[model samples]
Structures are given as structure tokens and as C-alpha cells.
Target: MRTSFIKKKKNASTDVALQITSMADIFMILLVFLLKNYATSVTNIAPTAHLSLPEVNKSKGVIKETLKVEIANDLVMIDQKPALALHAFQFDPSEDGPGGVSPTVARVLNEQRKLRPEPNMDSSLLVMADQQTPYSTIKRVVASAASAGFVDLQLVVVQGE
Candidate 1:
């Protein structure tokens, strides 16, 4: 008996490609969500030195229509306006017992608080100070605001880049 050899044939075909439309749709949804959550009225304060703020576990969101106090190296601003010039403070060691916040800061805060619709309501005051700023300076500013009847104080910090 004679045996014969046979050759096998291969199928020429390609697998189905994956569709990326679903992924694009998901990304679009995520973009919309992030855009909706973006803050519109953010108060930006440029500090003279990098400051690492003491953190708290609690989360405090922004309060609408609040006062802002910016403390720079040699000047202080209220609501982004120059309320007190550099020479406004008495740097003389003999005259001024200790460095103090400008009286105008307290007065302005008081006036703004009065103008607020809900004076009795709990309103927040945001304080932005440079990192190199001495603790005494921070305390003085906070004390002035407190004396002006600002109970809720929020120290502003950069959350992330």
C-alpha cells in the first residue's frame, strides 16, 4: 500500500478592533463634572515668602462675600486694596511698645461687617500671610480682626498645584 502526504491550509482573517468611543464618552463626562465644580470667585493673595500653614483635619469650604486680609513683608492689604502704606506703622522701638496691626484694618473690617446684610450671622475672615512673617505679626492681625467682631477666621493656604 502507498501512503500520500497532504498540506494543511491556514485561514487568513483579522480579529475585531476595540472601539474607543465609550472611553471618549467617559472622559467627556468627567470633564463636565470638573468644570461644574470649578470655583469662580477665588481670591488670590501673593505672599512675599513661602508659608506652610498649620493644617486641620476638618474641611472648611469658602464662605460667600467675606473679608480678606493680606499680609506682605512690609505692607498689609485689605480686600486687595492698599489700606495701609509701609510707613504707616511706628517702627521706633521707644515709641511703639510692640508692633501692631494698622488701626485702619480693624476699622475697615468693622465697616464692612456693618454693611453686610446679616451682621449677626456667622461670617468668615480669610487671612493670608507670608511664611517668613513672624508669629507675633500673625497674632496681631488676628487679634485686630477679632476685636473688630470677626469670629470666624480662615487662614488661606494653597491646597495643591
Candidate 2:
């Protein structure tokens, strides 16, 4: 009996079939994580030094029911109420009268404090002024608040654009 030898044939093609389900799952997980983190990390913007601020030794943080004062040209709003209506003044260090901030801020703060005086009141005065508002105005507001027995003063500003 004679035995015949046979040759083994090699497979011609070799290509990988990609499974996209795992890749899609990973992308979805990353997207969800990023979205969740972004939702939790929201923050407000604050202004820079292009705007001037007064020098105060004890600048403190803000608390609830803060007395917000807004100083704009020809307008002075106290706690979102129109407190004073006067012409806007320039930043003049040599001015004899009250500087940038309205002179009545102190009195207003004092009155508010008197009306709602509680032990260890942490309420603060929040000053929001325009960028163009002069340093004198800021100084005046700060001075008024300080004079009104508001040791805690917070300067509100917009964050970087």
C-alpha cells in the first residue's frame, strides 16, 4: 500500500472586526461624567483691578439679607431702592464735599441696623458700582458703611469675561 503526501493550505485573509459597542459605552460614560461635573462646578465671575477699590483693613464676606448699594451715574440705589438721585461726579481727590459714594449711605446703613438689630448680626453691606465709577465713589461708600457701624463690607464685581 502506497501512502500519498498532502500539502496544507494557508488561510489567505486576516482582518480584525472592530466591536464599537465598548467604545460607544466609554464615550457615553465620559460625556455623562463631564456633564455632571460641569453642572456642579458653576461659579460667578468677579471684576479685576481695572476697577478701583478702597483700602480697608477688615474686608469681610457677605451674609444673608445684605444691604446692597448700587452707585451709577446720576443714580444711587440702596438695597435696590432709589435712595438718592444726583448728578454723577468725577473722581476728584481734592473735592471738599463727600466723594464718589453718596453721603447718605452711612445714615441709611445706620437706620437699617437700628431697625433690625440682632445679637451677632452678620449682615454686611454690599457695594456694587460700575467699572467707570471713580475711586472716590468707592471710598465714599466704604467710608459711609464703616461709619454706619457696618464692620463687614463686601465689594461686588463681575467675574472675568
Candidate 3:
């Protein structure tokens, strides 16, 4: 036998409310984490004035922190200080020591080496040369750097698009 029962009354409020407090908390945490770890891995130093750096189609390897040797058409600077002057993209014969090494450049480099935390460690140098700089001038700078015990040399160039 089936029996009929009285129906229960329904609540007047039918809409459900969404609580976004937990979602807001998660969004804030993610924002702070991303901002804290943001980084830009690029060289901070700008190109010297009036210096046009060579452009390369493709560049390889990461840039390391090293002493800078900026070679322009008329001057050679070590760590932005004038080390020597270039006449016609060449050093004077009197300024050149044995094997085309520059005494001034070598002296400055040696002093920089001594100032380093570990003087005995292998030294690396960065060469930022103008596009108009001659090969001979670059060669002399390399020789001087070698005489000062800088073996690892890196050339700085602009990336071509």
C-alpha cells in the first residue's frame, strides 16, 4: 500500500555565493614569487662613444665578467681609463717593446691583475674594439695581455638581426 506525505517547504534563497579569498591569496603569492626571481642576463656596459662595434650574424657562448680593454680608432683604454694612444691605427715604434707588446698596456694589466682577489688565478680579458680598428692594433693588444698573463680573451660584438 502507498501512503501520501506532506511536502517540506524549500528555502527562499536559491543563489550560491563563491568565496574568492583563497584564490586571491594564491594569486598574490605567485605575483610576489615571480617578481622576486625576475632577472635580465645581459651586459650592463654600454658601447663607448663614437665606437662602432662589429656585427656578427651569430654569436656563441655566454658573456663572463672580465677586465675590459676598449680599443677605439684613436685610443686604447683599459677599464675605461686611457692606456695608450693610437696613431693611424698603430702604436708608435718607441711605444712597442719586443714582439710588438705594449709596455703601458702590459703595466696597467699587471696592476689590475695584482689587485684581483686571486692574482695567481687564470685571468680573462674582454676586448671591445671598434669596427675600424686594424688587425695589427688588436694583435699588439693581445700580445700585451698575454705578457700580463691574460690567456682567456673574449671579443665583444653586436648581435645582428
For all candidates in order, the CA lDDT equals 0.64, 0.60, 0.84
After aligning candidate 1 to the native by TM-score, how far in Å is the CA of 119 from where it should be?
1.9
Query: After superposing candidate 2, which stretches have Cα over 4 Å from the reference?
Result: 1-65, 90-103, 117-120
By the lDDT metric, which is better: model 2 or model 3?
3
Compared to the true structure, candidate 2 yields what TM-score?
0.50
**Ranked candidates, highest lDDT first:** 3, 1, 2
lDDT of 2 by residue, 1-161 (tens): 65646665878778988999999999999999999987765222222212343344544544344666777765666765666554563433333345344456666767767766572474576666776686766677677777666777667643332
Candidate 1: which pairs clash?
A: none
Candidate RMSDs in Å, in order, are: 8.0, 9.9, 10.2
Candidate 1, which ten residues in sequence have the lowest lDDT sum? 88-97
Q: By summed lDDT, which 10 consecutive residues of candidate 3 come out lowest?
A: 40-49
Q: In terms of TM-score, which candidate is strongest?
A: 3
- TM-score for each of the candidates: 0.55, 0.50, 0.72
Give the alpha carbon lDDT tens digit for every residue of 9-123 in model 1: 6676678788999999999999988777665534254443333444445546554456777776667777766665433222223222233644666777788778777877746
- The better-scoring model by lDDT among 1 and 3 is 3
lDDT score, candidate 1, position 19: 94
At residue 115, give the lDDT of candidate 1.
Answer: 77
Best by lDDT: 3
